[model samples]
Target chain A: MSLSGLNSLYREVILDHSEHPHHKKNLKQATSKVTLKNPTCGDVINLELNLVDGKIADIGFTGEGCTISQSSASMMTDVVLGKTTEDGLEMAQIFSEMVMGQKRSAADLKKLGDAAILSSVMQFPARIKCATLCWWALRKSLGENVDD
Target chain B: MDSKFLKIRNDFPILNQKINNERLVYLDNAATSQKPQAVIDEIVRYYQNDNANTHRSVHTLGERATEEYEAARGKVQRFINAKESREIIFTQGTTDSLNLVASTYGEENISAGDEIVVSYMEHHSNLIPWQQLALRKHAILKYIELTNDGRLDMDDAQKKITDKTKVVAIAHVSNVLGVTNDIKKMAQIAHIHNAVMVIDGAQAVPNQPVDVQALDADFYAFSGHKMLGPMGIGVLYGKNNLLNKMSPYQYGGEMINFVEKYQSTWADIPWKFEAGTQNVAGAIGLGKAIDYLTEIGMQNIANYEQKLVEYALPKLLNIPEITVYGPHSPKLHNGVISFNLKGLHPHDLATALDMDGVAVRAGHHCAQPLMKYLNVVATARASFYIYNTVDDVDQLIYAIQDAKEFFKV
Candidate 1:
């Protein structure tokens, strides 16, 4: 059986990000920190955001998860490192919607950077949570009301 | 390969289809088995003709429904060799059955400082109910450790069950480890300590012949879905005397004999435990599944599965990157195989396998405590059943190889 279908889900960039995750460390002094877990698979993300003047000055995460989750977390930290908290939350919303198979504009998608590649995760419905877990952590750390 | 077992795949229409442009090789039977056409037909036929509330109305349909439902209980009783049909209480599933026992029997028996013994290998359904019960009563909860090879450490079991131990609950087969615990021996140990033995037969009953009476278990619980039956239907078998003494699990219609102004009397052992409208179709479907299993013969099925494990386990172990969690020898292992590839998370492996039409389970498997004990976050599991064949095993090996290559692990 050909596994060509997997090419869309596990792209080279995602694998590379998983192998060498950016900003995967414990921030010593952080204004906000949240730990989110995907109880279904025991994946945990401890996200720390150092917000100064309502902007994310530094962001880091430490967790154990699959390649998708690790890569997603890496990409998330890279994109939202210096963005304002409001923009970070907006990016989280866009990532969540994109992975849920929702349509998003190119400008909104551009804000996500490499994380937008996970839109293919909509096909693998089961792994959608793995891809969005870090974004949820970002939202929760930012004190946003994440009902979903 | 047995010719009879070879032909068993024909009975499941769902197994005949293609998945992901490849021949579907279902290896997730430990989660839930594929229902045979006979079982499906039974449910449809029940809904078409004999759909009614069981043990309630006086109409002919009600009588037929009640008869079929009770007959299903009898099938379960005979299937597990329970002493009587009254000992078989129809439940929502294994989780519901376990909770029923923990609520009724456990609640009535356990007290402060009492101890409940469970193993690290228990599924959450079996472990959490007792754990919660112990917490509610301020009792102590103890665990039986596993041997280095992933088998239950019977020596630890002996050490754990003491005079303070009120209940010794364990799984008949480990869902992740693929090792069958010696329930009979464990029951003997529990009885010696005067503690009740609750056997979680959710994994065992579907794959092997179970004789609850021979095991002398106080309570035996199993789900129907894992045995080629419908979901939302399960069995909880308690000894007649124990069941007679325990309080009713739920209070509702059909469970009460008479309701006085302030109090009420309960029905018989089985019916008293079964409250509200029952799943008549599910029960009838379970009875059909039992009939199918009986025709195939439980011993034959067990032997066939052992053969499959013997054929599959060695090849699985041959992969240098793969680390199997259970016993390496097929003699000690069963159909359920949990493994992980070095540097490749199970979720990625499972996803890659799915692309090849190889369905597997990846996660903590609802056994977080066990996952902790194994020192891993999660692992991918491939379980076998009657319809799975040598070709399916070959497909699994091929898919694992493909996954490793895809992930470069």
Candidate 2:
């Protein structure tokens, strides 16, 4: 109970997003949809995005997973809605880099919106994949030039 | 903690350590048991004193190596009460042994319309090989359903196994559910249908006493590392008559009697199955592990674990919002418990528990069929062995509660 590492890893904000995830239903009329699975832990996400011209007009996700993954997906939908696909992919890179322990500038940190609290996920090496599941799906769905 | 387990755990050096500033509470026995110091020292002694290629030389070290290697086979033969040492083949692990049967015996016996029966509770290792075999031979694959309490339904089993059934493979104990199937009665049913019986004993051999003769299993397979032994060493117990007739799965050195340019004759029953260089040190270490367990007695180990489950299962059921899979009574199964905290995912729960220096497995447990049968995506598992104590279970319960509170479930 006194483990400070656990406290930061499961912060209040992250738990809130996980419990009450945003855009948690199926986007049946989506323009682009992609499914990703973490075969090791069986966490899966079906990411649906509505691209109007060059912007993500709407976003939603449906999946079953641990708190870190579900909440990460939830927070991602809130951050990427109404943003250009370019901005969404850029935000994903900044978010991935931040969680991977790369030094992020203040501007890049600000782009993550509410997901910046998940930077402590790096401390638990086993859970980094759980934290990055949605971002990968987004990058894949948008057909971005990801350096994965 | 039981008085017997206190001394039993002392044999393992890795258990007497700490992780993240807390004593390690290892409840991951179903994944793999910790190695005893005796098994470790035996592995080291082989390298230090008797290190040489076995069965192909006349030098002193070579002779010593061959003696110890085949002596290890004798130990395994005695461990499972096989008819002869030749009936026990050295395999890389349980998956390898089961695959050998599926490839060799299955290929020879299965016709285009033949049937292979497997239970719903089987691990992927036991399920996939026969699945591929059925696909390859154009045969039929049938499954026996599970009962409400997670045990195999005998009525369903009888109905599924029929005249077209040429083979039946089953898990001796479910890795996820912890229910021990009555393979003795199952073997009888398979025999009545003129079918062969194969038992996947990977989970059972580690916790209970298994006698293939008593079970009448045509082929029994298990991994050594699960039973306080080293990795890379396992045993396949096949009846000599059946093994003598089946074709070799893998063809290479040490497994053949004569190799012509076009044709080759096999060496013998077990050697024909074990190709290339085997895990000599691992086999010796596994033998030493058997010696360690034999000294403790497998029956005593089973009895003690049953008591541990009887003590722990009820308390776990008492937790709010906790959903446990498998039999409610401990006497009906071994010491494997799979449960879930309603709203929290197993991965998050396992990570939180790890922060408290507790280690348990969280996943589909390589038994997705059983997971589907139980109606869940995944679950958290806490499995016990001879080295585990009641105190470990207490800490696990406490850690689970902490996870529940942290997630505000």
Candidate 3:
């Protein structure tokens, strides 16, 4: 009856971010707006990226979903806002790998910013999609084909 | 009345399993009940011996298949006490059945400025079709609010259902709130307005014996899976006169009475609605499920589950900080209790219970409007059925207490 796997999926930081999300609104006059939804579970993500000189100038989002989805959106906005498009895409890739419980080192996830708290979600296989939904959309908004 | 059935704990094979290496205590009957061996055997027997396309071929097996399918229709008619067997149409499920009525019947009769009334407690399947139908036909969609105890506000229900209302569709029971609605009164109100009443019997038919004629409902919909049958089969029972007046939902080979170079006429009531090849095995399974229920007696099953709910509610309420939703008594509600442990998120609580081999649903139960009305993101639900016992509720309480201690919530 050990929920060691489940506790990691809903860590304290994730709950805190879900309760008080940063950059959770519509960005006024933002450059790019993209919407994605997990049709399976009805988790939605709306990403508005403000681009400045090919790097992320600002970012924001608003949607409804489970705690994994909401917190992941919060942490994803914090991570990709100030980074260049290439670096942002790279960070999204690493975060995706981390959530899937892939064998990626700390250095591999060092660039994911506050989203790294979700690294333990890899162990709980069912929640990987919830943790990576926002990161997947952010990468697509930045113009890379999000195959996963 | 048989001891084998009374002591039929071993009849359900799914109950003898382990999930994540823990014994399974299934509590999601409102979502879909676990099938017994008789239902499964009926499906297997159909595919093994009598598998044939119904109502088309002239061969011996085809005739038998067609007869069995039609007999199943009669079984359904008698199960719900519908006056005519032709009024029952096989559908994909409750969602598909409700959509069929909204799309085919509602499309033709409803027009601009007309109104369709539904309650806030309706499942998404019952709500969205009418909403879309209203939007498309330039009609208005009205909602019946709830009182503090989560029962439908009868005053609000009466006030909103007026002469302009063309259809009053509501659930016979709320899956999330566990409240059994007064469909007889609702049907009376709809008739007063010259509106058709559509009943969502998905939750009600499984838990109780329903008489559509007594309710005076124009249309009633229910699914097979929730009633201890196979999935992918549901029933839409309409008053024969109304069904005869309505148009066919889909067009295909089976539903046509006559086709010519220019014009064609659809088949009779139920066949006209069932356009394609129906789910034959699923129908047989549902028929077997109905037979099983008859053997145990629906009244007895309902009484047993009500007692279980009555027993469980007090134990759940005694938990110091837990917040139980819906009516506090089983007499005021169906056999369902949705609640939230003091500080534990529903998903977390469900996961914790899963570790202890207790299964419960932890979501909005497809009634997001009710969830929003309750002002919670999600709540854990434990629904009871005939197989559940007082000891099972005790095990559930112990498991919740264990989860509470482990999570310190």
Top TM-score: which candidate number?
1
Candidate 1, overall lDDT? 0.93
Q: Write the per-residue lDDT of candidate 1 for residues B1-409, one digit (tens) a residue.
A: 4998889899999989889999999999999999999999999999999898877789999999888888888888899998789999989999999999999999999999999999999999999999999989999999999999999999999899999998999999999999999999999999999999998999999999999989999999999999999999999999999999989888888899999999999998888998898888888899999999999899999999999999999999999999999899999999999999999999999988888989999999999999999999999999999999999999999999998888888
TM-score of chain B of 2: 0.98
Candidate 2 to truth, TM: 0.97
- Candidate 1 or 3, higher TM-score? 1
Model 2 chain B worst lDDT window (10 residues): B1-10
- DockQ comparison, 1 vs 2, better candidate: 1
- If scored against the real structure, what TM-score would every candidate get? 0.99, 0.97, 0.90
User: Which residue segments of model 2 deviate by more than 4 Å?
Assistant: A1-3, A144-148
What TM-score would you give candidate 1 relative to the actual structure? 0.99
Stretches of candidate 1 above 4 Å error?
none
lDDT of each: 0.93, 0.90, 0.86
Q: What is the Å distance of residue B294 in model 1 from its true position? A: 0.4
Residue B130's lDDT in candidate 2: 98
Top candidate by lDDT: 1
Worst 10 residues of 1 chain A by lDDT: A139-148
The CAPRI category of model 2 is: medium
TM-score of chain B of 3: 0.98
lDDT of 3 by residue, B1-409 (tens): 3343346667888888887676677888888999998898889899899989999989989998999999999999999999989989999899999999999889999999999999999999999999999999999999999999899999999999999999999999888888999999999999999999999999999989899999999999999999889999999999988889989999887999999999999998889999888998899899999998888888888887787888899899999878889898768967878999976667667777877778898877887778888888678999987677776787788889888876666
Q: Which candidate, 1 or 3, would have the higher DockQ against the true structure?
A: 1
lDDT, model 2, position B133: 97
Worst 10 residues of 2 chain A by lDDT: A1-10
Number of the candidate with higher lDDT, 2 or 3: 2
Q: Candidate 3 - CAPRI tier?
A: acceptable
